[model samples]
Target: MKIDTTHLLSAIEDYIAKADEDLRDTLENEGFVAASETVRHIGEIEDALEDVLDEDALEFLERVKEAEGVDEFLSVSWPDIKNEGDLEKALYEIFRQKFDEMFRSFTFSWILAEEPEIVEDISGEAIDTITKPAEAFIKGWSGELSRIMNLNTKDSMEKMLLKAQKKSWTIDELAEAIGDSGIRNHGYRSRRVALTETLRVQSYAQQESMIQNPLAYSKRWKHIMSDNPRENHIAMDGQEVFKREMFELTGRNGETYLVLCPRDTSLPAEETVNCHCIMETVENENALGMTADEKKELREKYIAEVNEEYEAWEQKFKNDMGIEEPRDDPSVTWEIYNSYYEAYRKGEIA
Candidate 1:
């Protein structure tokens, strides 16, 4: 099955652009009116946040009840479900799984709902990468809130755990500024954090969508090809790219590499924004002719050959220029490696 990287990338970009526009409108419509409100009423905002947490805990229980049969919920599951300690552990796991599904489903559904042309299967790894941070954040937030609930209240452990969200009022700001440094900092921090946490799921899904399509293409290639490519992975990008890219299986100095799928690595958010790079799986058919062990041995041999070439070139340049210092020049070596690889590909050298 051929995954259309172009369509997927465009859908993801379009979704983000639309979602961000909606979010900006929400923030502006909500935020503009609040500038004059000030911060004396921070307590009200805290109460709202608490209400979110409360609703989440209760809602989770409701979901669990709905998902599990009465026989299951009332049976062995009860022991763990009712046990405060065990329940918390179970709930976190449940939340992690639930949100992972929710974000993936929601984001994918959001696109399919609108465009309907974006039909691609997403990988578990990609789903986890995009959704895990938000899951961790929510888990931590809920756990912390549960720890602080009033024991005297009718609040259950579940309610305590889930009680959580942000912002408003003019005197709210003035009171915060006047009362305590932490108060202002706290308010600011709370709003900012709330926004971040709220946005995390969507942002991650968007970021993952930005790359998952092209990524799936590589994955599909791996799945269908009985002889998977063992050589260097190639990077392909459009006419317009941060840098229209390329890759090597082995560097001139014998440095081996594996291509990273976009958003899989820890490059900054801006780096992946609108990035059109897709990895082209390049396999050495000759490498596949050998057994697995033989393939490994050949790789080691190739590395040694490259290293020897590098050492000889460095020595030659050093002696020829009469430079006492031996410098490892990447640019010079890179050209040599490129030429060698190009020649190798053309059947001129191996």
Candidate 2:
């Protein structure tokens, strides 16, 4: 099935604008950082979705049309419903059921609500809310989907990774395994590219975390500190601990190390905004032959590369937009990446 990305992008932009307004009002009135952050995160997710939709405009349109049809069906007249309340409830139930089915069929994942005003109702005000963020979300999600599709374009390579991980086959693999699958592209280049990008993000997050919590570094990495462990020993082992813990948690088999944000502490509200702990894998670390200093140097070198790439991308975006002076907002970038990652995990973006 095909999908249209434009409609989805428009819907997401609207949703994000509304969400930002709501979050600002909340933050200004009561200093509700958590709630405000949630809204901001949603906005980022919307932005990510927009990026995806822009990549494959046609397919996005098709999916939106299908979803709209489902919504229309739920709204259409039913022969047996007589009460308004019953009708509303019935429509909600039907929409939820149908939406779930559609998402499963398409291997898409995202949150949907019976009422767009649900958040406002919860917030106890007539806050601006997107009644149907999905319309826009799908559009924004398409870009990521296209990237994922491109990554999973090879049959043998797809199977190799899945087999290595010992996980059940995914939609990408299923489509490839079956000869009649609609998808065409599937290869290692895509997988490697995706993995590398993810690693870069992880490294960025780690550095941001460290910069935000300098004190935490001493407490967590005491071994590296000037004080001896038996004397004035601090827990200056956070970065190393974080690296080990994250590697184990991701099941990368110690291949990947947490490059950024090695300690777990509440950062300043601004710094912690949309922070997602990510880890990077060192090739030599996997070989178990590299010393700690070697690994650290390699990670630092990789971080430099990530920063250079980021600067290039930022410059390109500014050039494309014809903006002589771009706003320095890490929060915005964080939100965008976080949103895309959330959509991917949720299957909202293939």
Candidate 3:
């Protein structure tokens, strides 16, 4: 269940590349990204931004044109999104599917350790391995997207307005000054979310592996940072420190590092977003401490807990959304969505 950083990062890259291609398809001939500087429209920068994009960006520009609200567009359009084609939702679903498939293979790998003769599915219990973390993944993904969007739109628009006050500017001038920050923000934020989600799935698999076969390995968690050629100092320091340390290592200066877990980090932004660090669980002698019966009991209890958590989430989702959970789909995606949305609605996620 350790973080396979290489595999995980490649997964993220594939997702981003796919997302960009999908978004481009959505944008193609949609009047979302402006193509030409037709004569009458060439005069003003505002017109370019207005005609340059539609969908969310156009919605935002409409607010500006009408002389209305500041944060007029999607103050996070996730709530209104219903399908898979949405940028954020699409990103989540991609990782969800990939991670689920990977974890299926991941869960099956345990069979190879002792019972090499048979290949069997955990059947009912397998869904929990994905649903539980997926619940958190969506919530985190939405939160991070909102944060990046707010900062990018507020700051970028403010600077654009400031510069526009001084003199008239062309489409290129204003765009260069303000930048297509929304795209940048989304791209960067998506990377962070994708990386984090992939790791989380791996972490859950680790948990599942541990519970199912406690004696298989006394798995100790370790932080495995990337050998990214463009790695930064904070990541380097994190790599150096946790590279040799174990899980739950505490700093002499009272800083705490949850090595294999997510969030609650003391690292600066320089290390987190686009970060290539990962959690790796290695076997230790203590793995043999738990007896066979104890391992089975632990595994049963864990699966039960995961099932309860997702059931509760699904129930709440049904209660709150006034719709039955998706009966046709194999994934607990809607259930996870409901859980995370409630968290966001109650302000518990932040």
Model number with the top lDDT = 3
Local error of candidate 2 at 322, Å? 30
Model 2 C-alpha lDDT per residue in residues 28-136, reported as the tens digit of each score? 3432223343344344433443343233333322332343232232244211111223222332233233322232222110111111111222232112121112212
Each candidate's root-mean-square deviation in Å? 22.9, 22.2, 15.0
In order, the Cα lDDT scores of the candidates are 0.36, 0.32, 0.42
Candidate 1 vs 2: which has more TM-score: 1
**Backbone collisions counted per model:** 19, 44, 4
Clashing pairs in 3: 1-206, 32-53, 34-52, 218-287
Candidate 1 regions with alpha-carbon error over 4 angstroms = 1-102, 113-115, 118-179, 183-185, 207-350
Q: Rank the candidates by lDDT, best first.
A: 3, 1, 2
lDDT of 3 by residue, 11-85 (tens): 988985575565345322322212121111212222222232234444434444443222322233322321223
lDDT per residue (tens digit) for residues 154-194 in model 1 = 23432322321012223333233323433112344334333
Error of 1 at 294 (Å): 37
Give the Å shift of residue 161 in candidate 1.
Answer: 27
By TM-score rank, best first, the candidates go: 3, 1, 2
